[model samples]
Target: MAQINLQNVNKSFGPGVPLAVNDLTLTIEDGEFLVLLGPSGCGKTTTLRMIAGLERQTTGDIRIGERVVNDLRPGDRDIAFVFQFYALYPHLSVRDNIAFPLKAQNLPTEEVNRRVMDVAERLRITHILKSNPGRLPGGEQQRVALGRAMVRQPQAFLMDEPLTNLDASLRADMRVELKHLQHTLGTTMVYVTHDQIEAMSMSHRIAVMDRGVLQQVDTPLNIYRHPQTLFVATFIGSPPMNIVHGRMVGARFVAGDGQFWVELPPAARQYTQHDKRVSFGIRAEDITVGAPGGAGMAGNVVVREPLGDETVYVVSVAGKTLTAKTPPRIRFNPGENVSVKLDPAAIHLFDGDSGRALLPEGWSKHV
Candidate 1:
């Protein structure tokens, strides 16, 4: 396995176009599963392509192992790229498709057969080895594509949303299988996806990007619990984080419109600047919904969405709508009054103007 590194990488199409990737510097440890995660047009795919040697960067160095590979051909990069679509050859049998790379390398017939069978067996696609890829199901075709990549035994695997074409249930199954496969193989992998769930569930670490800028890189849990930027705060969660426009008044956070206030926790007080504009953030799961006129801000439920295991409540509080994710048992109807309590300990603070997290020193110790 090899470690991949991109130092101060920048990609630009031309003078008129914006840089696709800007000053991106990141390192993927040997045998680590690192995911490039962001929404569309966020330069994630471009970054992946650059690492694969498919697109050359306009600036900076690209290193795989100990080699500077900026000018290397894709085939010479020692990386296997799994495209979003199952790019299996329609006319080739699954077995032949898996053995294609070995054939290109002029490996012995016996060695190619052995490698193909091994990968097929590991991927559990041996039963379909003789089947033509054109007749296979989407998931099976995907396996064929993955098997083809795996049969090569490349130094690293770069995947671009490889599960996007599968159905939701199949995608979930593949996520588990992929993670297991990565663990078993212990090869370096760089996966690109806009699906936060995929990134959160599969990656050892995630590099979040926005508008060509590298926002943050950390473990899935750390990125979720302690986002370093406003975009990350709202982007990584399912229901997203609930943010309130406000400013710090001493140790208290007062809403911009002067509707409500929350006392900052003592641990966070040292980081707060009196009269500084900031955004108060809390996850939907962190907001507690209680009986009306209880020990919190009173709000009227505007909408109730039942999501089987849990119910999402959209409450109108202080002229702002905040979503609360509560247990299905804690039912609340629209138009009903409820008390919404923001957990003081779970709150996140960000600079209102710059949209950057305002975290106290040693904050990672808590995460």
Candidate 2:
């Protein structure tokens, strides 16, 4: 296992095109599963390629273990890259595909055969060893691709959305298998993916990127609960955090439309003294919906989404739409009147203009 480090790394296509990665400095510890997460065209893939020596950084240094391998060829990097498409040879059998890398190095036939069979058994693909890539299921094909990478026994593994092509159920299953595989092998892994679930579920630490810039690097819980920026607050959640643009009026945050307000607790008083125009954010699950006559902000339900175990209700309040995730049994029809209660402790406050969280010092310390 090896620790990978990138220091002051920047990549650009040319003058007109924007830099793909911008002054990004991060470290992937030995035997760590670090995930690079972001939307499309966010330079995640570029960063991974740079680490693999597939794409050279325009400026700055990349260090694998103790060596500054900025000029090393990809073949000499001692890292294996598993592509999203599996990239297995169509004509070669699963055994042959997994053994191809060993064969190229001209290892003894017995050694290569033993290694291939071992990986196949570990991946539970030994039954399909004689099958071609074309005949295997998406999950099996992905396993074969992983097997090929495993047989190399490289210092680290870099994957670029390797599970993106599988069906939803299959992808879910493979995620478990992949995480277990990584734990068993104890190899340093740097994974790139846009799927929040994948990043949240599999990573030891998540690096959230946007427009080639690193947003926040933290555990899944920290990223979700204490997002450093408005972009991250809205990006990491499933239904996304519901944000209301408002101005502070004494201890209450009044919505922009002047139709509704949420009372701020004493803990939030310090943030409103100078910054009146603030953004109030709350997760869908943090808002409670009550019966029409109950004591809370009144709103009209606009949509009801019944997820298996939970239900999401979108309500229009103060000219803004806010979503509330509630128990599945708590049914409310569209146009029905309801009361909404925001959890003061769970509330997130941010600056309207700068879009940065205005966390209280005590709260910040806890986070």
Best-performing candidate as measured by TM-score: 1
TM-scores across all candidates? 0.96, 0.94
TM-score of 2: 0.94
Candidate 2 structure quality by residue, lDDT tens digits, 76-191: 99999999999999899999999999998899999999999999999999999999898888888999999999999999999999999999999899889889999999999999
List RMSD in Å for every model shown: 1.7, 2.0
Model 1 gets an lDDT of 0.93
Report the C-alpha displacement of residue 51, candidate 1, in angstroms: 0.5
lDDT of 1 by residue, 1-367 (tens): 8999999999999998999999999999999999999999999999999999999899999999999999999999989999998788878898999999999999999999999999999999999998999898899999999999999999999999999999999999999999999999999999999999999999999999999999999999999998999999999997999988889889899995777788887788878799999998899999989899898899999999999999999999888889999999998889999999987778899999988999753553443
Model 2 is weakest, by summed lDDT over 10 consecutive residues, at 358-367
Runs off by more than 4 Å, candidate 1? 361-367
